[model samples]
Target: MQVILCEDIDKIGVAGETKSVSEGFARNFLLPKGLAYPATPGNLKKWESEKHLREIKLVKNLESARTLAAQLESVALSVPARAGREGQLFGSITTAAVAEALLGKGFSVDRKTIDISAPIKTLGAHEVTIRLHSQVEARLKVEVVSS
Candidate 1:
């Protein structure tokens, strides 16, 4: 039996793909679980149109991510922290603080998206990576200054 997959099945096929399977498997497992639909002429036509729309949406999303990445790369953030006579800070700069600083600059960034390999403890320039999208990443300089 031929069926169009609605969702990706491990070892079988991905979503929006047509695959051949046993009649029993198609009727019992794929149909009952709503994982696939029988590939009739009408269904094939519907899937083609839906596939085109999905491609368009993916292109738009990629463009948007690239734009955001460019904007983020040019931004330099300054974070103020209380420190002693030396350059050592009383506390480390957290991901939440970075997100807050970005929010202050009119960019609503999520703390989870900011990747800091280690806690910032010194008062100097540091590199921070922001995962804006799966295909896009932006690196920005974070300057920590004593308040």
Candidate 2:
């Protein structure tokens, strides 16, 4: 089955894209959830017009994300946590904490955007990646210290 995506779906495609999928999956999941529509001739034409509008909106959003990424690049966040005598933190620093720190610095970034491969356990400086867009990524410095 062919369908037009109305929003970005991980492992699938982005909005305004036409993709093929199993008929059962399309009919039972995507179409009912409003994530996509059947790729009929009328819908395809509609998607063509919507694509231009979506492109413009995405461009603006990407620009904003880039600006935020630039601000984030210069920030050094300090995360304080309880630690043991060996300097290992009692609990690991998570992406949620990183996102909160970024929020404290005036950036409205989601936790999903933070790409921490592993939980931060030691008390020291670390580099983390913040994904602003598919093509825009920024590195942030995080310093973990004893509270």
Candidate 3:
């Protein structure tokens, strides 16, 4: 069966993509969950138009993300955490903490967008990558110091 994806599906495809899948899967899973619609002629046309608009929006968002990235590059964020004598924190600093630090620096970064692979265990300076958009990424210097 042919279906148009209404949202991004991991291991499948992005929104507005038309793809073929098993009829049972399309009807039972994707359609019921509102993740996709049957790729009829009307729906396909609608999807095409929606895809064009989404592309334009994505371009504008990417430009804004680039500007934000530039601003983030110039600022260093400090995170205060409880640490031992060896400068190892009792609990690691997570992306949520980084996002909070960014907020303190006047950047409204979403925690989901701040890509910290693992929590910072040792207290020191670390570079964290913030994914502002699919194409725009920025490095933020995070200084973890004792409180």
Candidate 4:
């Protein structure tokens, strides 16, 4: 069956894309979920007209992501925590903590987008990765100080 996707589906296709799939799958999952519609001639023409708008929106999003990435690169975050004499933190720093710190700095970032490779149990400086977009990433400098 031929379908035009209204939303991006993993392992399938993106929005405004036309694809072929098994009839049963399209009718049962995609159609019922409102993720896609039958690829009729009228729908195809409508998609062709709206394609330019989608492209423009994508370009704008990419530009904003790049700008955010640049700003994030220049930011240095300090997180104060209770620590022992040996520089080990009483508790580990979490992604929620990092997100809160970023929010205090006037940047609204989701905690899920922040990636820390290991548990921050020691007090020092560490690099964290923030995924702003699929094509843009920024390394943040986080300094952990004893409170």
TM-scores of the candidates are 0.67, 0.86, 0.79, 0.74
Writing each residue's lDDT as its tens digit, candidate 3 over 1-147 gives 989988767678877888899999998899999999999999888877787788888789889999999999999789999999999899899988999888888888889877776779999999899987766799988999999
In order, candidate lDDTs are 0.89, 0.89, 0.88, 0.91
Q: Which scores greater on lDDT, model 1 or model 4?
A: 4
Alpha-carbon shift of residue 126 in model 1 (angstroms) = 0.4
Which has the better TM-score: candidate 3, or candidate 4? 3
Q: Whole-model lDDT, candidate 4?
A: 0.91
Q: Write the per-residue lDDT of candidate 4 for residues 1-147, one digit (tens) a residue.
A: 999998767689888889999999999999999999899999899889888998898789889999999998899899889999999999899999999999999999999889999999999999899988766888999999998
Best by lDDT: 4
Who is ahead in lDDT, 1 or 3? 1
Clashing pairs in 1: none
Residue 14 in model 1: lDDT:
72
> TM-score rank, highest first?
2, 3, 4, 1
Residues 1-147, model 1: lDDT tens digits: 999998767689877899999999999999999999999999999998899787787679779988988998798799999988889999899999999999988899899889998889999999999887656788989999998
Residues forming the 10-long window of minimal summed lDDT in candidate 3: 7-16
